[model samples]
Target: MNALKINTFIGRQYDSNFPEVITDAVPITNPLAVDKAYNILEENEGDYLYGFVSLIYNDVVIFGEEQLTECLLDTWSTFSYLLESRYDGSKHHIIFLDNYPYINTTIQENGQYYEIQLDQYQCFLVPIEPFKKELKKEFFNFVEFCKNEKLWFSEESSYRGLLETYNEIKISK
Candidate 1:
């Protein structure tokens, strides 16, 4: 899974390594004020600060729901219009962590090179409500609309799995 690359600094000042695709970035500070992002994040587990940007595939992942509340909240302060202007269901996404998660890219400055190490893998989808009933409700509603509208639902179409799952969910309910 190739994640959107975000340039992070180990000791504050970010470099120009930021990917052109990721237009939004955190505040340029020696130590990012992750404390300020608290309202969006679950309270800090301890004394640590870090920042992140994500390109989530969708609300649902191989893992679970793309917990975007914090990322969405931070964009209000940091990116301002990035999310609202460009929230394509599968491309733009965000997540928050109290600590640094990925290894910073190393670069040669002047004549010297440095490596900014991150503590965690930096590419994990934060674990949120895996079985969100609200999202499921929306999905089922879409499926119902499809059934009503007969969207690609002919005998030759591939809705057998969908019908089977719908039947299972119906029976369980």
Candidate 2:
């Protein structure tokens, strides 16, 4: 069995010469940090919710950073494409991150599994069903979080489109 996990964090924007400086970060899973993180996201609406996301496989961090500045909405939007691709039977997909190093993760379907590669040296095989299950769960949970917080984008048509896509994927084989 392959162990795959996705964790997202909410981070505060800090003044810096470089755009990647985010501080006082906290995981979305942290109950106490939820409101505080939401406040930071609300205040920095123009900045697009500075955040971080990590992909862990079998206890190894495939990609992540404590200070990396990632736009929460955009990252989720990008990841949604993977679900679409998988549903459409696409053999190959690549997810490009929006921050430093500009690393792109590749996912290639091989039979009942996806071979995910972070780089030449880091690769893992995960069964397709579990990957979809975890991704969908996290995506929907984040959407619910945004809705409960009454985030501005939660009402946007684009965000609604994501919810629609998620529903479609959920009912499909």
Candidate 3:
């Protein structure tokens, strides 16, 4: 089994124009938890949803809190392309978030492993199959959650784009 693990949370920043009202992070354990988090954010009149995601390998934090400001759906949808890169013969994939406190994550394939770098500083190598397996599982789970909540129909363009890409990725896989 691969030692790589992915953890994520969803939270909101209310009153985003003036003073920000940051909500506590809600652990993304399942589809219901993500739905509940968004529902609560909507109820509280949040401007948007954002969150943190970490990649842990063998009990070490490869990517952590510095990346907390990413828009959850947008980041995940972009990150999903990493999986596609494996099959498309693309050597490297980078996920860059241009929001406040910018985040840049790069993943490059080397032989049977993928070397992942965060902000050009932190780096680690994870076996290709395991990394793909974990990422695909995490992404599909989020896609299922989006479908269950009808986000493609009710939410903004980001959600719609995510669903569209999800369908493409599913069909390609």
TM-score of every candidate relative to the true structure: 0.27, 0.72, 0.73
Q: What does candidate 2's lDDT look like per residue over 4-118, in tens digits?
A: 8877776654546656764566777687456765676567553456666677777777656632554666667656677774445454434333553445556767798777765
lDDT of 3 by residue, 1-173 (tens): 45888766665334356556655666576545667556655653443346666778888887666566535766786678776644553445444344443445667778888877665556778888887888888888777865666442334436677777788878977
Candidate 1 positional error at 82, Å: 30
lDDT of 1 by residue, 25-50 (tens): 34323223232333212332322222
TM-score of 3: 0.73
Local lDDT at 91 for model 3: 47
Pairwise TM-score winner, candidates 2 and 3: 3
Question: What is the number of backbone collisions in each predicted candidate, taken in the order shown?
Answer: 0, 0, 0
Per-model lDDT: 0.29, 0.64, 0.64
- Collision pairs in model 2: none
| Per-candidate alpha-carbon RMSD to the true structure | 19.7, 3.8, 3.9
lDDT of 1 at 32: 33
Error of 2 at 2 (Å): 3.0
